[model samples]
Target: MWISPAFHLKVIRAYDALVTQQPHPGAIDIRDPKQLAIVALQLVEVNRDLQAKVDTMQVAVDAHHRIAKASAGSRCVTDAAKDLQVRPKDLFSWLSANRWIYRRPGGSGWLAYQDRIQAGLLEHKVHTVERPDGTDKVVENLLVTPKGLAKLAVAFRTPNAA
Candidate 1:
């Protein structure tokens, strides 16, 4: 719908009266569609530039947070695998080779060193499974941390980029 400049001015005046707004804009009234179109184009360009800046800032913030977390130490493997779109076992295999996770003494499973673990990608969980005879047993599992995720990210992304 085409809004006459007079009507637009009246509406603005009414709004100003209602709000008692201060420091009113000094731009002249837009009487022609061509003028409105030009203003619209300028506004669109300004909005696009603003949005682009916001996107850049957001990316920078995300990188900062990720770096902070990655160096903080501590995260699970399974969740990290999910983030990297790989299997937990496969990730663990890579982690073992990378020395992020180490085997415990006396035939026990691996243990994540407290100092080495980075940002937590997932939490360790205990699951109860029922056997055929109606007996339930508990199983505990751990996942890779942020540092591990960072390692996986670098190792996986670098080769694929080529």
Candidate 2:
């Protein structure tokens, strides 16, 4: 319940207006109950307005926190597509069309673009697989980071705005 200096100034101005009966600054008469009541009501009105603004700001902060929580970690493209409410194939196609990802020459797996990886929007997770020949093959999987997921969510919601 911290009151700003500006709010304090507003209350002080209201007190001065009621006491001096003028459009300028002055001290209030502590002995007069009627003047005190008018100033009290003005202060209450100002407080109510400030409270409304604070409540609005609080709601925005809460929404931001919820979005941050929902987009907290990187996920595979399939899981990311589920979060975005789009099919995995559609998501992959969109990413490819938008130049966010691509397949290396003669490769099956998708790879993130260098710029996307540098921008902290995408990442790579490498794994080693054993083939029938008993040899380990290194594979890289592309993943969307939390920041990228949030961006994609907004892009998917808007029509032709991404």
Q: Per-residue CA lDDT of candidate 1, range 13-104, in tens?
A: 87986698543464545776876898899999999999999975665455444445443544456655655556788888887786666777
Model 2 has an lDDT value of 0.81
TM-score of each: 0.36, 0.55
**Which TM-score value belongs to model 1?**
0.36
For model 2, how does the per-residue alpha-carbon lDDT over 83-159 read when each residue is reduced to its tens digit? Answer: 76678999999999999999989989999999999999899999999999999999898999877886777566533
Q: Which candidate leads the pack in TM-score?
A: 2
